[model samples]
Target chain A: MAKQIVKALDGAAAVAEAMRQIDPDVVAAYPITPQTAIVQTFSQFVADGLVGTEFIPVESEHAAMSACVGAAAAGGRVMTATAANGLALMWEVVYIAASMRLPIVMSVVNRALSAPLNIHCDHSDSMGARDSGWIQIFSENPQEAYDNTIQAIRIAEHPDVLLPVMSMQDGFITGHGVERVEVLEDQAVKDFIGEYTPKYSLLDIDNPKTFGAWAFYDYYFEFKRQQTEALSKVPKVVEEVGQEYGKLTGRYYGLFDPFEMDDAEIAIVVLSSAAGTARTVVRKLRKEGVKIGLLKPRLYRPFPGKEIVELLKDVKVVGVMDRSIAFGSIEGCGPLYLDICASFFTYGNGKAPKVVDYIFGLGGRDILPEQIEGMVRELIHIAETGEVKQVVGYLGLR
Target chain B: MGELIEIRWHGRGGQGVVTAGEILAEAAMEEGKYFQAFPDYGPERMGAPIRAYTRISDSPIEIHSQITSPDIVIVVDPTLIGLVNVAEGIKEGGVILLNTPASPQEMRQKLGLAGKGVKVFTIDASEIAMKHLGRNIPNTPMLGALIKATNLVSLESVIRLTEERLGAKLREEAVKANIAALKEAYEKVQEG
Candidate 1:
């Protein structure tokens, strides 16, 4: 195994370091809260000549994605970084980039959307883009952010799954918080990602091709179906790439990471940094002789429905904690909650646990261990009584 | 550091509170310990009150939340004592390190920390920084006091890591002066 060099870095800096190592052909980004450090640090690398990447300081997030699409379609390895409003601004291009099958890797520092103009951590930004056809992966800390960013390149460029990837970390929490991260050697990363050899490139004059070509009735549906088919392959590709990265770095990743779930009667399903807190709570509860556990999803887009159902089917009660709200939905739960419910409803063979939703940490509200403990206690109650008083609940709300 | 040691840093923007946390985290990393450092990022304007946090442990830190009940609180800006509740949610027997010209006893009285079971330490870190660096950036000096109060990491390691982190960006003279400030504050910090 290759030796790992551990350094203290924030999620943004870690992602920037990965980008420096990958040295993608193009990085077009606009500065935004929480995510600004990623481009700022990467641009410093460009100025210092550490990486030979063409850094484009675009005016808007939409323009940034547009530039990325143009570069990626030209057979270049392209990347970008953005947060809440920026991701919202790139709404049109975000879907287009995926539909065009451009392998653009984007770092989405997760932040809350604005009507109140708050710049704090939440899953709303990325969850809003969940149906936009991008492969979404969430990171718990700087280490995962670094590892995911590096692995995302290979996953995006995989021939069987040529799709854009959004590697997400919590805004401010992970983006600004510095932690110990083990970085692989540049040569190892370069070799792992190899090269981006576009099968159909606009730059390849010998084989003429048109990207984002207009398709009416018959072809548009087929193209959409093809995009859906491509998405179906992402889970396998993600796992394969994750295994390869684990072999090199010893930090393995799966669709979802289960902690202390072997004998857990009650579990909490969550994502990103909250999962870290949930794990800590699980340890505490386990010591207290409670069969509590946590399930943290690293891969969000492909949802990993069957795998998640399989994991939770044996549990008595499961609580789904979401950092973003799915407003106006029938259940009035968060996006992740809706997905988990949908998964159980579809694939559960009458062994599905009674799942409840807890919306927590929206707009960067702090979710303390005590709050998690309370949620677990509630889950235990649900398991004991075989009744859920409230299916959708809010945590840490006054 | 078998258990997690959470530290809350209170300072103003541009005072290097965030950088102090980063340098301390780097020193802890050098000691082969797991650590996390982060600022409560807000609309950053110079002189606006800011807060940063650090968590050092022998094992990996799994929780990612604001340090509500800190084991140690380091106040880099003396004026912030009245503006913000610097002692809010401090764990019982927690240590409070302040950069003030006042004596530890006087500071304890002024901050109303008497009989709180909280240990208070004081250092004229701003004066030390001004004497060494000719500026009021008390972050490095406060870091020195933090090491003296908590002994979370060695002073030598912190100075070395400071140089490593700031060497490329700062002038050689500034780096030397900052190191000197750290050493001076380490020796000068007084316990109440």
Candidate 2:
């Protein structure tokens, strides 16, 4: 396969290219900065007659989701992309898209959800929608952004899992990073993932199914139970699809890739774009005889716990860095990982790794390798003599 | 991993520096290599001066975001030196692809370089764009100099991207003149 070289592309174009390969029935999106160019390119695709897809220039991000939900409900494989404030605007109906279980896939170019109004990349937007009944996946690079968009469609529209999925990439990281990405082949993708066969849809007028039924107290719990069961099965489906994708493309997609953990006493868990920075530190430390590993959570909603516990089995220290603030919480993703580690210790009757929470790169701050290396050094010091640094620390604040 | 060429462009808003960066990206994407093109909007915008960056590599890019460290810096405007600190973060082997009519020696002196090992390729790209394109859009012509200076991606590939990415109506003549301007810019480039 010949590689296509691009000098630079804004974040929007990178996403728009992936959408073109998916070739959905309709794409409805509202314009929002950092995200506007993606739809603008789609609109241009519509105008140039380059793609045989209908593009709806909607009034708002909320409308974009509504239109896609309606389109997917009518048996159309639909997708949309939006960023920070736009995702917040679509908050109300986002729950509806998931609860009614429209297999809609969206790209959340992550940005901070505002009180002071920021447009830069932050996990706040997607993190706020954590419990929205959607299978959320975070991508580390443009290649993942491209591959994940297509897979997101396949996963969301799966027969057993007719749920909405929001595929996320950092606003500028994967979005703006101009790197060579092998846009997957359409036939290979189609053969590997099959066509979108939505099990049940409102579009079938012959049968006529009522979606979003007003469940009374007697039946609501069971309906909710079934949805939870359905959501639980997503990780398996994701693994299956990822395996098939790996066979076609040489790059294997793991829910979490443990780098240099084979001989590690400390493991750092990062999400989205910062994983690359962590890996750099991981590589440098390993070469210098430091046993440091990296855990990047691909599927945040499904939270790959058992795999994490198994990977961290021998390690003594675990550092979790979260890019968003869950105010009044333990800070960053540390609390969540802390809970996971605490559970492991409780259940396994084994010592849990000394866990530390880190809050870094919020509102587009830099995640440098030195900072990562410095933390690992601190962890090593703690490992040598059971002393601890501040458990919940924010990186790069002076 | 093949030829990790990073080119940095420095210019103020409305100077078409960012456009030049995009042109380089367009050209490379035409050649079918994994390429990234973006600009740094650092608490900055029109008239405030900013940077547009590019990284061209054969392998899939794992790193994203700003080109904090660059292999080449394209200075579209010279007065930027007196105002903005243009030479902030350049890698060890990196070069400056500037749009100046000065000889390489004169440029080195103007840039306060006498001892440091730096390759400065100077071209009057703004003049070429005006002469050929009948507009002050130095992006195309300057890109020609960029191709000649760094030899990153071919000038032909750039012309192809311009055709593919440009509107259909503007595709034919714009591609032709841009190629010609690119040739002029590439020819005028003096490496030192």
Candidate 3:
């Protein structure tokens, strides 16, 4: 019930603690930057027999995820982690893991895709796979990385919610920062996140069911329907896990964590670790009597569009922070939300919040709090007079 | 509603810098505090520089995110001395604990810390690790010095975390050797 204090830890350590506490039966890992330390630490736990989890040292990310899929298919409580290019390598099998409905949890540290080839943090990698059937949760800090990782297994294994889940933190940002993160007691975590036995496992040799076999149109439609049906449980499962996690630890994790907008006239929405920087600015600007707030979207993929539109209903101005660049088009991830908000506005007959985009921190550049403050101020300025660029506000670009 | 204490770690790939950050966070969690630790990297390869961070808070933290500036910056490799701008974004009153034999004066000159008011401290952590642990990996030794330089956490905390993190065969020896390495560094550190 008590809290702990440590100097700092990065994203990799947060996931390792979750794995140790869960003590999965198998861990299939392939090395990649940012995500390497996580599997390495767990592999050590496996090597020393500290954990009874079967450690599978696979040769490649494709094989690493394939092994996890096999382990999960076999009904073994399995775990693993990979990022960026390694994830790209495993792209096909990832869909298999989801379609098969194996409740395997993995950590995906967000990294930029290569053209120029950068190792800094960005959303391009994850955004590319947005349509893949995994329940994705983006964490803004180390604490969330730990808690959400633990929650992923719980949410994924729920009989009503048997789909793969991936919790992502910015590669090298939340992934590598050393902050004091609260780790629940092994028993508490185990208690909070119960055993992860799958509903149907490949290990049931007696059951003798065909899996990963080809399905024609006759069975394909139903399977696809079932896949869609499983996804329908995500919102409820999120609510359930957030409730239980809140009961166990006092933190509330959800679709959105809005700040300073109780009665604010203008607001900003942000995601990932960058929200921390935005919050500091919101606090300072709020003290100056600025009517600005922050709407942070934690659940990115299963776009909580209506929920977000409702949250923005009364607000006059909204500034969306995109930690990525869309390049060649004005439509990066942030603009997708604008589309949702716009539809809601159309429903309200042109009575919705005025929307704009603020792209910042591409390639993991440092975005200062004052910059977020300035973005919100500019949004408020636009709201007061209704004159701002359609393509507006890219922070941290000199 | 409670505030959090955020920390960040920076080092190279081969160095145990990320390990040190995780072990420290684990130690604090053992103390029954709300804490989390993690690392940040992109291209996973040897010789590449890396960073790790942690957060300890009094209440539930919904905003799972990355740390920007850290309260304590732990440098485990001397090579990082040139590769990283290590002291950037460290809090005003924060301390920089490095694993080098250079004095605070020599380090300030070499590290170009003439203007910044942040405290600079160092310990021969690699030398200490080589002597005590018989390995070039200086994570534990620098962590020892870090615990000393900034009493952000206790030596017992570090040992507890070390035990939780280290392999059993090496656990006892590691606890003894690394703790000793920390004490050696702590005693040698100055507020210069």
Candidate 4:
């Protein structure tokens, strides 16, 4: 095992440290709440000459992503960081960058969307961008944020899966919350990420190629089909890279992490930092002889539907906790619940577990252990009675 | 002292409450213990009341939620005593260390801790800071009080970590004066 260099760093600083080690060719960023520290710290690294990255202090998030697209298409390793509104501003270019197949990596510090204008931890930011053709990975803490960042470069640049990757962590919860993180040596990161050899670069004059070409009816449909086909190849590539990374470090990455779920009669399905709290709840419940467990999805995009269905099929009752609301849906559940329900309906073979939708901790509300214990109790009731009073419920809400 | 010790820090934005938490975390890390320190970020301004948190554990900490209940609560700004519920949700037999000129008995009455079973400790940290550093930055002095009250980590380790963390950014005189304030507060903290 590699000697672990433990340091106290927040998620943003940890990601910045990983970026410093990888030392990508270009980093175009604009400051935003919760995510400002990432760029701020990396820019200092640039100023201190710790990394040879071209740091672009862009005007807006739109311009930031645009610069990333330009640099990435030119065959340079590129990355950026942003939160809620900043991500919304980068919407158009976000899709274009992925469709153009630029292997750019980004750190998305998850935050709530605006209307009343709240800047706190929520899955709304990244959840809104789920269909933007980027591979999304959610992290539970600073360590996972750092690990996911380093792994994302390898996954994005994989020849079979040339797609932009978003490594996400809760905004103020993980992004600004400090934790103990074990960082790998700089050389190990360099060897793992390796050099970016673009398959088709705009800068390669010898084999000049056209990108973002206009496609009409006959070819546009085919192009969309090809994009889906490329996306289908992501799961295998992600797993392979995860296994290799696991070999390098003891920390293993997977589509989803299952905790104490082998024979659990009741379980909670969640993402990001909440999973840690759920695990603590699980331990407490387990000690009291409650067969409860937790399932946390690390890879959100490429949804990993089959894996999730297989993991939860045997459970009697499951609660899907989502940090982002899927407004106007018939079920009125959050996005993660919607996706998990859809997955079970498709692949569960009529053995679908009785799943409930829980909208929790939106707008940075605190989700305490007692609240999780309440959810577990509800799940147990559902398992025994085979009845769910409400299909969707809000946790820790007034 | 137990499996984990969670501490909540209350102070104004510019008082270095966040940096104090970070410095303590660095000291705990130096002791080879797992630690976390972060501020509850808001639309921060110079004197706005701010909260920060720190967790020290023999094993790795898994929970990332806000420290709703803490084993120790450190108040770096004396004005925030009644404005914010500094003693809210403190663990039973927890410690509350305050930077104030008032005696612990006076603080207990002012803060309404008559039967809370929580130990109250106070030190004129601002006076100490003013005497040594010529400023009222009570964070370092309050940290010294924290070490005396909770004994979560060694005073020596905290002072050394403070120097390593603030040495380059602060002048040598400022660093030395802060160390003096830390030592004085450590010795002068009083309990009710």
For model 3, the superposed segments whose C-alpha errors exceed 4 Å read A1-9, A216-219, A326-350, B1-192
* Candidate 1 per-residue C-alpha lDDT over A1-398 given as tens digits, one digit per residue, 9 for 90 to 100: 78889988899999999999999999999999899999999999999999989999999999999999999999999999999999999999999999999999999999999988999999999999999999999999999999999999999999999999999999989998999999999999999999789899898998998888998996999999999999999999999999989999899888889988888899899999999988988998899899888899999998899999888889999999999888998668898888888898889975688999999998999999999898888898999999899999889999
* Model 4 whole-model lDDT (C-alpha atoms): 0.91
Better of 2 and 4 by DockQ: 4
Is 3 or 4 the stronger prediction by lDDT?
A: 4
Docking class of 1: high
Q: How well is candidate 3 docked (DockQ)?
A: 0.27
- Model 4 residue A353 distance off true place after TM-score fit, in angstroms: 1.0
lDDT order of candidates, top first: 1, 4, 3, 2
Clashing pairs in 1: none
Query: Which parts of model 4 are misplaced by more than 4 Å?
Result: none
TM-score of chain A as modeled in candidate 4:
0.99
Q: iRMS values in order, in angstroms?
A: 0.7, 3.3, 5.3, 1.1
Model 3, clash count?
56
CAPRI quality of model 3: acceptable
Give per-residue lDDT, candidate 1, residue A77: 97
Evaluated at residue A189, the lDDT of candidate 2 is 57
Which residue runs does candidate 2 get wrong by more than 4 Å?
A: A1-11, A48-54, A331-350, B1-3, B23-34, B42-48, B58-60, B159-174
The lDDT leader among the candidates is 1
